[model samples]
Target: MELKKRIKLAYNVLANKSVITKDDQIRSMLDFLGIDQAETKGAVSEATYYACMKVLSESVGKLPLHLQQYTEKGGVRKAREHPLYNVCNSRPNKYMNATNLWGSCEYNRNHYGDGYILIDGAGINTKLWLLPSKNVEVWYDDRKILGDIPDIYYLYSYGGGILKLGSEEVIHVKGFDSLDGITGMSVKERLKNTVNSGIKSQNLINRMYDSGFTAKAVLQYTGDLSDENARKFTKGIEDYATGKLKNDGIKNIIPIPIGATLQPLNIKLTDNQFVELRQYSALQIASAFGIKPYQIGDYTKSSYSSAEAQQLSFYVETLLYIIKQYEEELTYKLLSEKEVAEGYHFKFNISVILRADFATQVKTLSTAVNSFLLTPNEARSKLDLGSVEGGDRLLGNGASIPVGLTGIQYMQNKNPKKGELHNAKK
Candidate 1:
């Protein structure tokens, strides 16, 4: 009942925002909701505070009826009879931790082993009912220790407990040291190795193309090429075929002779050969300038023989050289201008206000002051305050005043007429 009351109070406090104040109030509320005191309290070590928080957290969620049920059902014995009993009894192993025991058979069985049991006893008329399938059967000293008996006899007669069957229980026991020898390799490492090998093969093909091998050279290296590299090269060739190289000004290059020309050359350059020629030329130019080819426009063909087929190898190589030069020139320009510009600057002004009743009065006063200071020009103009200036003050009466002074000034014309004195005080 106390726990229920505390839970209700916590819910009410969370719903109604007006009752809470200070960090301690929040801590007390959390304590009443059964949150761990150590987790909520940080490093504060006052005995009374610790005791109060502990009692509150411990008492929270604990019902008298729950205790009575536990007592009537024999507490721990009833818990052992629960469906989760076999899962809890299984010892923790290297692959399976204590937390794994809490999950269903689907997740836990994958690593730990199949830990479920199914025993059918009910006939068709009664509908199927199952007793737990026993894995390991324990025999008493007096009973003949020969063959297996029904699990029911072990449960009812002998005090010896029976463990439900699992893969681990069925298989012969292997020690912890066995896992050490089973090399643990990751998917990422395998993928990386495959990619690196592809890159190397592509580099070799590029070298071959630069050495003046024709499109057929790519087919020769196709056996050595990885699936990933082949796919990439094929994609590059497709892009080349569709005139995408127009951006690099190689779309118009025609290597093959027209119909009028006699004995036209058959240039069957493969994807790898084209990549090789472009990369080789780019590298030569980049080497001359003491830079990496990727820093420039590295020519990438859509297909294996795209460079040779489209006759864009020379132009693409030249473009990469120009790109490298342009990048270097732009970088130099940026560095030269960096010293001329100034860094960022900012200004701040702080105002402090003090009041005895902080919660009720100070908050209101601070808000009003801030609102007045931040009011729009059109709104401030209605009060006849000409333009807002830093440190300028406005009196309750329609008067513009300077800051740091508290007085009203009046100017009088000095002249005595008839029976009136100009300097008379009201």
Candidate 2:
């Protein structure tokens, strides 16, 4: 009830200018819609959802994904231009691109505690469509867990129906859910109070600037002609004070009658107070959504080094969780039975986030070449350059040679050394 009142307050404050009705009428309109005013106050009003969505969406969606197969030497290499890779890269479906799909998944997961992708085919599940958590209900009976494919999902939106997919269809991607429910726990559900508080603070700021600024004053009209005239005079005073009767400073001075007195009211809210309150509330919202303050372009509590570290921490701590969830789900459900047995699986280019500055890249690549971990051509490939002649040969001065006798070692092994000959002759 208290939250509903706060939502009503926020709604009234935002909608104050749209209608001339009293506050009760506005509350009735909101209530008639069966909408909990605070329901949208979480993501729609608070900065938490926007900041989290921007970071998670662009980072997860824009960065490339790869389809990789194990190589002869047992090292996994990306199968570039693979059909599945092209599908995920260029288009996930007819309606949305890869960025939009992944961003929607991450956003829905954050808001609803679960994200789902519906695959239409049986093997090599490539055909994908995203579903809203609220619309798709997970249908799992006792035996549904042991089956290869997930249980049939009942989709409620767009003229509802049950989706009877074949085996290994309808991929389920969920975040951390301690109760082991079908969907993971939603961030909004847990942080309702914290989020609402931030929103209420914002609404408070809006209220302060919006209709809340009306100053109440005392006026003494000693020689009023009639009750009707006094009411008219009071209305004029309100219109003038609130700037409703604007005359572009032409009527700056008003000559009062014989004994009329009006003095302005003393308001308590100051400019600095709102600034400080808004900043403090922002930090609270940022923390609730696992976003750093600076990520949302709030740098008041951040420095260069700390902000950089916070970015890395966000990738490792926050983004990694969601990425891994996708990777595992796709690998398990998307791959064919033979492909899985043959070691074909899924992996995201997580190291893409580790791209360094120019100087750092040069230093790192040089070190990798010197250590023989990357051949010169491999290093060139990283820099988007073509391979040069003789760049394929691994060059290093380390004693850990490849397991084969060189010409020098074989010749020395065939004949006695000169030093041994000299000792024998002596």
Candidate 3:
């Protein structure tokens, strides 16, 4: 079946409130969409499922604006000539324009320099503004100061020449030079810092391993067994610990004695019992029964014989009891096989327009606006706006204006930053 048909069928089933497993639902959806079953026969990988969901979610949107903007050239021109342009150009009276006052006295009033003199065309003819009376020292914003001296000072764009004033003092100004070729102690210090970080990471891993608990002990405690079998399993463990089973590894020995009669042992549990079971580890359960967790596995395997079978049955019931107790802690629904199959079949109608196809669709609307039959806002509304794929709102068939553009208002809100959609979903 085609994927679309299969999805339709799945949607019908879901609408009827039928119970089905998650896997079944996915399978049905794929079948409806006409997706080949052979292409995805095994367990669904996380990546494939996520990709399919993403495509389905994004398939309803219109073509991006950049591609369609060319169709509305007249509207674009009108927007640039709009009265809002004059409002943006007007500047505040107090803030002086730096470009206009560069060589003027007004620049000295705004800047933190003493009287400035513009040297006109000496050797380079470049405008050299000087702060001679006061030695203008520049410090970085983050630089620390000790008394009147800054720890570090940066000189920017000093004229490359020497100037002598009267007979008393001379100032030497040199062009900026980079320290790229200069190697010093700072490089060595950086290398040491990197090595120290690696050592710290290794120490953290070692500490985690030291404090970790073993999985074997936990599993044993959680396993269920009859009283007699439990005792026998406990004894076997003790024997192994004491070197009694040194010659024969515990793997060769059956922890629960053979020929032990067993009966169904039902443990009634309340809501609180369920909650507490989730808190207990498998090791804790094994400790309670005085047996190893692996012994429970051995007991389960030995159930083929009539006597051992009885003990195994009791252990099986105990396992179910623990499971029931833990079920309360589950956060998601456990869909049945059928429900899952049907969920896979859920139908969603997705409208897709190729770049070329979308252009054609909006061409008529653009023509109408260019001819002045429609205003820019009116023409924009006629072009599908709500159909944007991957946007927050789902599009339904209607003539409603696109979000952020309604009535006579044409304010352009900033586009969301990259990765914002993914973050919003999370």
Candidate 4:
């Protein structure tokens, strides 16, 4: 009955936006219908799940997100002068840094299945704020109330009331398994069974320890006592097992009542393969998050070489999609139409995260320079080395020729004996 009331309240909040609603009304509405923010947090209390979230959030948080502009030479450079550049690159608002903004956004994305950034103002006075995904509801403007064209809008329940925001006002980072593109399926919802099992497994272990490592058993009594007495007796046993009945250190003896036989179950956690079950659950959850087992400190079958390969694979497979989504969303929502048309957008410097060992990096850069794929100065810039004289030009081995002249050298040689003789005679 209570659940139904809350559901009705939520519908009311969504349907009627004629007047402003208070915080209490919004709170109750979310309490029943919205994402269980508490439950989402509790799920992260599991070690494996928390680790995966941390890995993803921190991976994005550490990289520099810059506003970039296309150069005449068809290359990109940071657009330092743009008004919104500093907001995304460093301080999003007075209270948060870029790291906090990105990390919190990712954490919310994983926890709530959607993360939102509200673009508070326009132009020079712009302020970016992270909105709690639970409090924000997405609605499509099917009625064309806001504009003639139907589009998605946001209803944010905050202190004052439900604030209706246009699509441009919010940046919605969606998760996987979204039936409708506007909303995403949260990790907690998608992997509820596995996560719940893990939590239960942890609780079971805690209970076992609290009972002084005792297994469950049957207390077979010959006769039944009165209801009150039975209740008291059960309470006494539980108190004794949990060490709540404090007598002066009478260690290691649980006295059995007369005519009652305690039949031990002889079941052990080891017998049930509890450890293996936990490991399997961790791996399964991690895999769902696109995390390699080795990343979460499970290097059971890892080699140094394989670890290196997995690191590259992690960037290509996992982080690439995550970064690209962020870049596209940020570019679309933050930049003006004119700026986007002028080829100005946002990009994350992912090279910082994918940096290889010094020796490998040097070798790779050297090969790029040798093949004329990168100018000597360009390769030097990657190493943070100062440019040397004449290093700006593309330099390669003498034997290598341009793609257009691939067979021209051979053709010249074949017709070349006559040409060579003419040159010699001259």
Candidate 5:
């Protein structure tokens, strides 16, 4: 297609055409990161962007990704030799480690409402790279897609020089976009107003500091005064406020003229209004980004238990959904049609976040072993200990049950000592 026809098709195909909105910051962000950079605007504040991205990236990066094959009982995990495993756990690309790959996917998803993980190579040997949604244009016939038998997919990826666009046949691991098409709703876009309010609040505070912390004050005179005299009086007051006193070059104390009285007009406005506005604005921004309010130091009406619950909620409600989306995307995009039919899939092991202390782990493993759910060797292996000679045998309540109906018989046969009696079955 020629540039003119392609441009027309692009507009016809894309839900949001190329055109930056009026807001400068939002327009720049969209042009930089939107699906169609030529014409779009995504609302996001400079104040809360880093905080939102940091929280999301760290939350996702710490999870362990695994490739598993289904079994009759459940699914058995595969690592080391698995081709998908190596790509996800060992190496993703030349520049990024496993954490970087996972975290960057999540970071872009949160910021752009969609993240594209491009998969390269074939079978087990694969490489993954993130494609900014702003630079990616998905081209497919709408009628073909509705029929559920689309023969071709044209994904245009723009990178390299200013006007260069790259085309590829293989599809990338597509992050879940809240919206249906290229134009998706992001957290940053959702909190545009709140973040803008925060920006305005910050500006107000900065203006306060920049004007020697006395920008809200006014000059008034009881008797008639000329405009020139009024200007002079104001200058005198400003000089006194920011003047040298006690040989110090600070603006704290000032000597007033004999009959002049300086009354602060916005004393009430400066006291708690802006502070509360900013505090509320910060909470809204954090909430919009799915971050715990306490994480950003909003302790209003917060208690120890509440904070703990919020932390767990962040993992369970927010991060778990994101992690599951990534797992499904990786499974569908990474595995072949034959592999998917064979029940191969990807999963994230989030147990690291819930990892208990050494004592707790040992106690839990011991209980599992005593209940005959796991052998001693299995528990030891979990603890990274080498196997011992009889560790594989399952031990009942009272030593090994070679030929016993009850644990008491074995206990009586052994005649356990007082300390050993603690292992007796109830």
Candidate 6:
């Protein structure tokens, strides 16, 4: 295609309502012009990126998602009797379990900037289907063709055709970067330079190995040689250097032609600090994902205490955002207005992941039970222990007194007819 025509077509494509997105049109135009864009999915090949994805996906997927209801006392309990409980807590669909579904959703959210879940069916037969973010496009119904009110719609491009779903039919978990709040900006779009640099550094190391780790050098000779002789000499040097022409199990010791001296260029990898640059790039990528270096196995500066603290920091700084978005989307999309108004919502059992050491857990639970913050059975239930007799009631230390009785102890020995001095003596 001609440049002008391609540009016109790109503009038209961007202007079209049926197009995937404006970004998609721009990317397609660049692709047509032989310009390659670094893809977010391609970053998964990088070790740190893969580790970050795994850390987040597993951390969230392994935790139990509960359909909780608020009690009269303002405490929450699992609403196991609700029809959505099984869908949220255990089996989401016939093919995938809750762990796989939630993990895939989280993975897609981080990789593609938005994760989608199709809320299929209604009432007791409802099933959740995880949709690929690549095929799903967020579209606005400015004309209100789908409904009486202007709202957002999801256009899922599948092999058969495009499936238009309403906003209520899909649960969309958006990433950290979103300007319009409808579509999210991917990590690849935001950190393209960093990702490309990391990929280039990896490729450079790989090419060095492939080239037999040879340094750039110039061949010096006293006399000019024929083109044929020069070509033969160059091929010989390359074959020998790359071990393609090995003798006596020796390689990389290229034999110089007669009257020729090879002068190597002194550009050491150390001088460039290639390793340090790559390490820095890794840190930057990890930071972009809100991942700690220790989580990805770069524990150079980590200690026992700091590592434990990083676990909490990881939850607060990284997983907290992901979990909150998931909870909000799931609750809003999966529950009806009545259910939401009645305090029925979806929540992740974060305690499953934020659990402390056994000793710490025991002490913490004991403290909660003794302080009357948790009933004895509640503390036992957290530890997966069955309740004992009289465990349902809250336990507390005997030192606490009612607020109204605060000054009663001081007046215990007071007599209405006695003076202050007589009462003090008594």
Give one digit per residue, the lDDT tens place, for model 6 in 224-314: 7799988888777767767886666766467886888878776788899988888998899899989888888787867547445767878
- Of the two candidates 2 and 6, the one with more favorable TM-score, higher being better, is 6
TM-score of candidate 2 versus the correct structure, residues matched by position: 0.74
What is the Å distance of residue 208 in model 2 from its true position?
4.0
- Return the lDDT, model 5, position 324: 76
| TM-scores vs. true structure, each candidate | 0.13, 0.74, 0.13, 0.80, 0.69, 0.84
Can you write out model 4's per-residue Cα lDDT over 1-426, one digit (the tens) per residue? 377787877766777744434444556566666545543346888889999999999988998998999998997778999988899989999999999999999888988889999998888888899998877888899999867779898998876777888898998898876898889887878889999889888778777778877677777777979989887887766666657665757546677889977787777778889899999999999998888888898989676574457768888988888889899999898887999999998999988866888998999999998887899888989889999999989888889855554555555466567666455445
How many angstroms is residue 216 displaced in model 6 relative to the true structure, after the best TM-score fit?
2.2
lDDT of 2: 0.68
- Encode model 2's per-residue lDDT on 33-123: one tens digit a residue: 6566664534556765567667776788866777788876888877664557766666777899887888888778877777877775543
Where's the lowest-lDDT run of ten residues in candidate 6?
Answer: 416-425
Residue 2 shift from truth in candidate 1, angstroms: 72
Badly placed stretches (over 4 Å) of model 4 are: 1-41, 146-149, 220-227, 230-234, 257-260, 301-304, 375-377, 385-426
Ranking of candidates on lDDT, top first? 6, 4, 2, 5, 3, 1
Error of 6 at 218 (Å): 1.7
RMSD of 5: 9.1
Q: How many backbone clashes does candidate 4 have?
A: 0
Tens-digit lDDT track of model 3 for 221-300: 44568999878776665454344664665433434335442232333335336424422332333333223333433343
Per-model clash counts, in order, read 14, 0, 44, 0, 4, 0
Q: Which regions of candidate 2 fall more than 4 Å away from where they truly are? A: 1-42, 122-125, 143-154, 160-167, 211-235, 247-267, 270-277, 303-308, 398-426
What tens-digit string does per-residue lDDT give for candidate 5 at 1-426? Answer: 345654554453354444322243354444344335321223343455567678888878887788888766773746446677878875788878889888887776777666666766776567887666565555554576523555435353343322222223233333344555433467666766676666666666676666666644665557878989888888777776644342555557766766667877555555767677777777777777767776776667676464345657778866777777677667766777888787688888776666666888899999999888888998998788999999989775865553333555644557776656555533
- Which of the predicted structures, 1 or 3, would earn the higher lDDT when compared with the native? 3
lDDT (Cα, tens digit) per residue for candidate 1, span 1-426: 278877776776677534333344576587686676543343113222223223222221121100001243333212333222222233223344323321322221211222222222111211111121123232332343332542222221112433333221121111112334221222112233333333444455565455334232222222455889867755565344445676888664423223211232345446348656545643443343233233344445234353233223322432233223222322232212322122111101001111123354445544444555433333344334475654234223235344432232432534545344322321
